[model samples]
Target: MIVSLIVIVVIGIWLMSMYNGLITLRNNVANALRQIDVQLKRRHDLIPNLVSAVKGEMKFEQETLEKVVQARAAAMSVKPGNMKDLAAKEGELTAALGRLMMLKESYPSLKANEEVNKLMEELTHTENQIGFSRQFYNDICTKFNTKQQVFPTNIFASMLGFKPEELWELPADSPERENVKVDLSF
Candidate 1:
């Protein structure tokens, strides 16, 4: 009887530890995702300034400017925790920004604008930060998902109502992954 009691106690402790570990992993994923949001917000805030700085100079490229503005608005509308929608919107925004950058080759005047240049540099840096944050979030999500799938932990995770998280991945056929084409001949 004493042996049985000791075994039960041990199992209870192990289950508690597993539950706590899963919670930590889940929180880590949330924190990492917040980091990505911060960078994205910074990038979004920079867009209007960038658009206005080049607006007068790139009259011929109005379509590209409009696309950027529309994408930014769509991206801003996405709520936090909607990873799938956020990824899709972000991909669209990135593609629009890429097209806007390509216009620099066609309009040297835009490239020379000091304010536009500064904003572009800040946006590029924010993009890099977002990329790094995404990688980190994915890593944490993978860890959390793995923990939730493994043998004994899986049983405990499910019982505790812990669900797997979606990773921030661009769709396979997203045009954002495509190279930006520049038409320099005027």
Candidate 2:
């Protein structure tokens, strides 16, 4: 009887620990996603100011500006997923933004404007931060998913109803982002 009681107690403790670990992992994923949203919001806010600043100088690039706006709209509508859809939209938006930046290069006055320069700088910094935050989120999701699928943890995960998280990713076919690389030769 005493041995049975001890076994039960041990099992209870183990289950509790597993549950707590899963909760922490899930929370980390959520927090990381929240961080991305925060950075994305900042990026979105900067877009209009950027567009407005360059509009006058970039008179002939209306098509490029429209693409940027459309891409932003698409990105704004993206939802969470571990698969291709989410990543593709993100890639598209990033590519469009890349195009917009390249267009800016042709207009020296726009590039030289104080407000445009500052906003561009902020947008660049925010994009870097968003990328870092996304990596962190994916890492957390990987850890959680691995734990949920592993042997002992898998049993506990199943018992506790833990499931894998969808990864937050950029669009899969964003050729634009791929082409936006700087020429580092200099």
Candidate 3:
């Protein structure tokens, strides 16, 4: 009876440990996503400054500017916790930004503007940071997902209401995936 009692206690402790580990992974994923959100917000805030700086110079490219503004608005409208929608909107914004940047080839004066150049640089840096944060979030999510799908933990995970997270992925044919061709013939 004593041996049976010890076995039961050991199993209980193991189960608790698994549950705690899953919770930590879940929290890590949330933290990572928050990092992405911060970077994205920075990018969104920088867009207006960038648009204002380039507006006067790129008068003929009004459509391009409009697209960028629209995309930014769409991206900002997505609610937090909706990663799938966020990713889709973000991809659209990226494509719009790409088109806006490409206009540099047609408008040499805009590209040469120091303020515009600085804002573009800041936006690029923020984009990279967002990418890294998304990667970290996906990594943690994968670990958590695997833990929840595997043997003994799988049994308890469902009981505890753990669900897999959606990864931030661009669609296969998204223009955002294409290389941005910059014309440096200035």
TM-score of each model, paired residue for residue = 0.89, 0.85, 0.88
lDDT of each: 0.88, 0.81, 0.86
Cα lDDT tens digits for candidate 1, 73-111: 999999877888889899999998888876675677767
TM-score of 2: 0.85
By TM-score: ranked, best first: 1, 3, 2
Candidate with best lDDT:
1
Off-target runs (Cα >4 Å) in candidate 3 are: 178-186
Top TM-score: which candidate number? Answer: 1
Model 3: worst 10 consecutive residues (lDDT sum): 102-111
lDDT of 2 by residue, 1-186 (tens): 999999999999988888898999999988888887788778888888888888888889999899888888877777754336556766677777877877687788987789998988887898898789889999999999998998888876877778898887544455643655666584
What lDDT score is found at residue 130 in candidate 1?
A: 86
User: Model 3 — TM-score against the truth?
Assistant: 0.88
